[model samples]
Target: MSTQVCIIGAGPSGLLLGQLLHDAGIDAIILERATLEHVLERVRAGVLEQGTVELLERAGVGERMHAEGLVHEGFAITREDEVHHIDLSSLTEGKTVMVYGQTEVTHDLVERRAQTGALSHYQVEAVDPQDFDTDHPHVTCRIGGENIRINCRFIAGCDGFHGASRRAVPESAIRTFEKIYPFGWLGILADVPPASDELIYASHSRGFALCSMRSHSRSRYYIQCNAGDSIEAWSDDQFWDELRRRLPAEMAEAVTTGPSFEKSIAPLRSFVAEPMRFGSLFLVGDAAHIVPPTGAKGLNLAASDVHYLFEGLRAHFLEREDTLLDAYSQRALARAWRAVRFSWWMTTMLHRFPDNAPFENRILETELAYTLESQAAKTALAENYVGLPY
Candidate 1:
């Protein structure tokens, strides 16, 4: 097979970038190692910043989201039995964040790409970027059980954090920045009404808890757990019990547990690789960086990367400007670093260390108090959570 571009992974970054490139009359093929069903069922980030929604709107994939999505004006920071609210509208000047799943966005892109009759293959095993030529590159892969080779002018490594494509790039040239948190989150998606009108980031002696909703009938809640905690150890009843404990007294019974569609354990970590591009290949989404789930930045950052990567591709293929391609790595790194810093900061603030040291406890309490009492701190968080603006 031969094309102008070859993308690995059918996730949001790859699918959305393919959508943009297809709209620009640029041809590309996406290869995925997992079944479409698996992709559709994967549960991840649910928050979309203002800029991401706008891009989706322009791409015509925003119809379903606009109809079904929940728009929020602000979120609260809770500590010492008091909740400090940051009005996103007041701080960001009219920007709003939408509660929409990354899977839904991928579904929209998949349907739209199918409507356009673009080339996309699922259940592929290997996608190797061979010799690189700036104007022409080659990808070797096995789709289903057959080995196939694809030649292209450019390659997109959107496979994800534990994907084959990222390893294809030599390790010597890549400098990775990473940090691991002492705790992780155990989350459940239940068909219950939400406990609060806004998402709550609660700091308690037990640990960090998040109160968030998925839909009117489906609510998502998370509890801070040991790094090695297992879902099997916590039965449905235990899950609900922990949720009740971590939540404030006022919200003890505000949330109910029902049949849950998804149960997941996500470890907290921040990771980023410098220079998202190497020769004719480029990386996007999880392949380039990963933010801890605390700040709800995973999907939003992936969307932002696709925006810049697609623009860089457009610059090279349509406008004959290679300068943007040369600068793609540096441009993406800037935003990636910012998100890394924010995710780390939020994680450090909200999570409780196992040591339970007196000094660490004071630091956490002090920051939480500042967030609630200081308008400047609240405004800063409001601006970041809403978005960085386009």
Candidate 2:
């Protein structure tokens, strides 16, 4: 098989890129190692930056999102028992974020891709991109018992951190930076009304806790835990009790406890692989970088990457230009590093460190205090929260 672009992974980044390419009358194929059902079943963050929203709208998949997703003009942060709200709309001149799950976004993209009759192969094995360094590039994989080879002008590696695309690169050619936090987030999804109108992030003596919602009736909550903590260690009742202890009294009382439908503990980490391009192969989304979920940049960063690559490819195919394509790595990394810094800052401010010196802990306290009290600081936080410009 021959195509203009071959995309690895059926996640949002791959699907969104394929959709944009298709709309431009470009031919591309997507390969996924997991089944369609598995891709849609994975749970992820739901905050959308304005850039992500506009990109989804451009792909013709924003109808459901605009209809069902919650619009958050602001969110709250608490230090101990004191609650402070950051008015995103006011601070950022009416910019706001949409609370839509990443799964739903993937589902919309997948459905749209299917409707377009595009080529997408799910449940493939041993997918590999070869000769990306040269003009001629191709991908080889196995479907069922049949071996397959696809020739393409370019390859997009969206298969995420552990996928074959990044692994395909020679270690000597790539440099990675990472910092693992001392704690993880123990989170749960439950069928109950949200404890507050907007998301609440709390920093307490016990730990950091976040009260968020999937919808008006479905709440998603998280509390910080030791890095080595197990999901099985905490029962539903215990999780709720612990969460309430971290939140301010008023917000805690508003929480409506119920049986949790999903539970997991995820370790926090910030990772970035520099220069997202390797000849004809471009690393998109998690393949290039990863941020702790504190600032909700995981999927947004992926969408921004799609935006840059899509523009580059569009210009290359439609106008016969390679400038954007050549600058893809530099442009994408510039925005990605800013997000990484924001996520790292937020994580440091809100979570308790196991071995921080007393002075360092006091500095964190002062940081939060100043951020809430100073208008300029709040505006900076709000602007970053709503998202930096594309």
Candidate 3:
């Protein structure tokens, strides 16, 4: 088979790129190693930056999001028993975030792709992209116990961290920087009203806690835990109790406890592979970078990468210009590094470090204090939280 572009992975990034290319009258096909059920069942970040919201609209998949997603003009940051609000809209000149689950976004995109008759092959195995360095690129994979090859002009790698796309590149060609945090987040999803009207990031003597929601009735809460902690060690009641201990007394009193439907422990890390574009095999989303969920930039960063990559692809195909295509890596990396810094800073400021010296602890305390008390600091946080311009 021959096409203009061959995309790997059926996750949001790959699907979004395919949709955008299709809308532009460009031909592309998506390949996924996992089943359709697996992709849809994965629960991920819910926060949406303004640029992400706009991109979804441009892709014609924002109707359901705008209708069901919560619009948050601000969220709260707490130190000990004190709660301070960061007004995102006022701080960022009428900018706000939307609270919508990543799962729902993927579902909308999947449905739209199906409606448009875009080609997506799920449950394929041994997928590989070859000859990306040359003018002609091709992908080989095993589908239904049969080998297949697809020739294309370019290849897009959206298969994520462990995907074959990045693995196809030689280690000597890519430079990766990574930091593993000493802690992880133990999060649970429950069918109960949120503890507050808006999300809360709390730093207490014990640890860090976050109060977030998937909707008005479904709450997603998390608390810092040991990096090696096991989910079996935590019960529904125990998780709720620990979360309450880290929140303010009033907010704790308002937390509605119930059996959790989903629970997991995710280790925090900041990772970035420099030069997101490896010849014609352009790495998008998790294939390129990862941030601690503290800043809620995981999915948003992926969307931004998609935005840059789409623009580059559009220029190359429609206008026969390679300027945007050549600059994809530089442009995406600039924004990605900024987010990585913000996520690292937020994670450090909000979490209790096990190896912190007495002076370092004092500095972290002061950092939160100053951020809440000073307008300049608050504006900086709001700007990064709402997202930097794409």
Candidate 4:
């Protein structure tokens, strides 16, 4: 097969990129190792930065999101029983975030792509990108027990951290930095009204907790847990009990808990690979970087990466300009590092270190207190949370 772009993975990043390129009259095909059903079943973050919402609109997939996604102008930060609000809209001059699940975003993109007749192969195996550093790049994969080769001018590596795209790059060509936290987030999805009108991020002596939601009737909550904790170790009752303990008294009492429909523990980490572009291959989203979820930057960072790459491709194909393409990595990385820093800072301030010394605990408490007490600090948080300019 021949196309302008051969995209690996059918996740939001790859699918979003494919849709954007297709709208520009560029030919692209997506390859995925999982079936469509499997993709839709995976749970992910729901927070959307303003830039991400705009990008979805640009791709003609924002109608459902705008109709169903919740908009928030503020969120609360809790220290023990006291709640402090960060007014995002007031601080950022009317900027706000949309609380929409990534799953819905992917579904919209997938449906649009199908309507447009874009090619997508699911359940493919042993996918590999070959000759990405050369003028001619191609991808080889196994589909239905048969080997297939796709030749394209550019290869988009959106298959994520564990995917073959990053591994294809020689070790000497990339420098990676990573930090794994000692704890994980034990999260649950339940069909009940949220505890509050807005999300609440709480820090307690016990640990950190977050109260979020997918809609008015569906709530998602999380509490910090041991890195080695397993789902089997937490029953619905125990999980709810632990979560309520982390929240302030009023919010905890207001929470409505029922049988959880889904439960899992996700480890927190910050990772980045330099030079998102390797010759004809460009990495997008989790393929290039990862941020801790404390600041809700993971999916937003991916959206920004897609924005940069899409602009570069659009310029290359539509305007016959190579300037943006040549500068994709530097531009994406600049914005990416800022988010990484924010996530790291939020994580450090909010999460309780396993062996936190007395001095370190005091410092974290001081930082949180200053953030709540100072307008400048709140503005800074709002700016980063709403997202840095793409």
Better of 1 and 2 by lDDT: 2
Q: What is the C-alpha lDDT profile of model 2 across 1-390, one tens digit per residue?
A: 999999999999999999999999999999999998999999999999999999999999999999999999999999889999999999999999999999899999999998999989999999989999998899999998699999999999999999999999889889999998999999999999999989999999999999999899999999999998898999999999999999888888999999999999988999999779998999999999999999999999999999999999999999999999999999999999999999999999989999999999999999999999999999999988889987
Q: What is the C-alpha RMSD of each candidate to the true structure, in Å?
A: 1.3, 0.6, 0.7, 0.7
Ranking by lDDT: 3, 2, 4, 1
- lDDT for every model? 0.84, 0.95, 0.95, 0.94
TM-score per prediction, in order, is 0.97, 0.99, 0.99, 0.99
- For candidate 3, the 10 contiguous residues with the lowest summed lDDT are 274-283
> What C-alpha lDDT, on a 0 to 100 scale, does residue 289 get in candidate 3?
95
Poorly placed runs, candidate 2 (over 4 Å): none
For residues 1-390, write the lDDT of model 1, one tens digit per residue: 899989998998888888889988999999998999998888877889988898787666999999988999998767636667778888878888999878788889889999999999988886788876356679998987899999999999999999877788788978888888877899998888888888888877778889898777778889899999988898888888877777677876687778777888898888998879888889898998999988888888888888888888899988999887787888888887877777887888888889768988888778777777888887788888887753
**Model 4 accuracy (lDDT, Cα):** 0.94
> Per-residue alpha-carbon lDDT of model 3 for 1-390, expressed as tens digits?
889999999999999999999999999999999999999999999999999999899889999999999999999998989989999999999999999999999999999999999999999999999989888789999998899999998899999999999999989999999999999999999999999989999999999999999999999999999999999999999999999999999999999999999999999999999888878899999999999999999999999999999999999999999998999999999999999999999999999999999999999999988999999999999999999998
Model 3 steric clash pairs: none
Angstrom error at residue 20, model 4: 0.5
